[model samples]
Target: MADLDRSSDDTSVDSREDTSQDSKLEFTEDEETLIARMYSLLGDRWSLIAGRIPGRTAEEIEKYWTSRYSTSE
Candidate 1:
């Protein structure tokens, strides 16, 4: 029982680390250019755009694009 608890705790910690890492989304200059070009060609097709960029998910790219480009109102 104690070992199982420890195992679960370790898994939880690992998942938390992964989540934190995923949240810190940093795009390089080349990636930014690619994203812009892809947006022009694809027009909001996030999944298709993400498929072209290695190690990026559609949600991450969409979030970055929105935060970087969205107009403040």
Candidate 2:
């Protein structure tokens, strides 16, 4: 039981660290422009779009786009 709690705590800490790190990601103007353009051309195909933007992963791009460009936002 103690071991299970410790493992769960570790998982929670790792997820918190991930979210904190993700919040720090910033896109350059050029990269943002490129991502927007690529999104327009490619639609919601994030992996394909990410390939065009160096140093950015698909997950990061998708998260940023959804947060900033989603219709609800």
Candidate 3:
């Protein structure tokens, strides 16, 4: 139906917007150091870690940590 097509198009546009927003998220040196220190203390407590940093969410912090540290072995 036309409504179904419109919904799918809206979903694609929303996904694109989400990707752009995520790509724009970058951490500063101080923020990275803080994340490291917090991780050591908290150990996968992303909500707690995110609370210490301004303008960052738990999901973003966790994604960064996983991408930067996780090994694909």
Top-lDDT candidate index? 1
lDDT (tens digit, per residue) of candidate 1 on 9-37? 99999999898776558788999999999
**How does model 2 fare in lDDT?**
0.89
Q: How far is candidate 3 from the true structure (C-alpha RMSD, Å)?
A: 4.4
Q: Model-by-model lDDT, in order? A: 0.93, 0.89, 0.92
Models ranked on TM-score: 1, 3, 2
Residue pairs in collision within model 3: none
Worst 10 residues of 1 by lDDT: 19-28
Which tens-of-lDDT digit does each residue in 3-71 have in candidate 3?
999999999999998987866477888999999999999899999999999788999999989999999
The candidate with the higher TM-score, 1 or 3, is 1
Best by TM-score: 1
Those runs of model 2 whose alpha carbons end farther than 4 Å from true positions after fitting are 1-24
> Which candidate, 1 or 2, has the higher lDDT?
1
Superposition error at 20 for model 1 (Å): 6.4
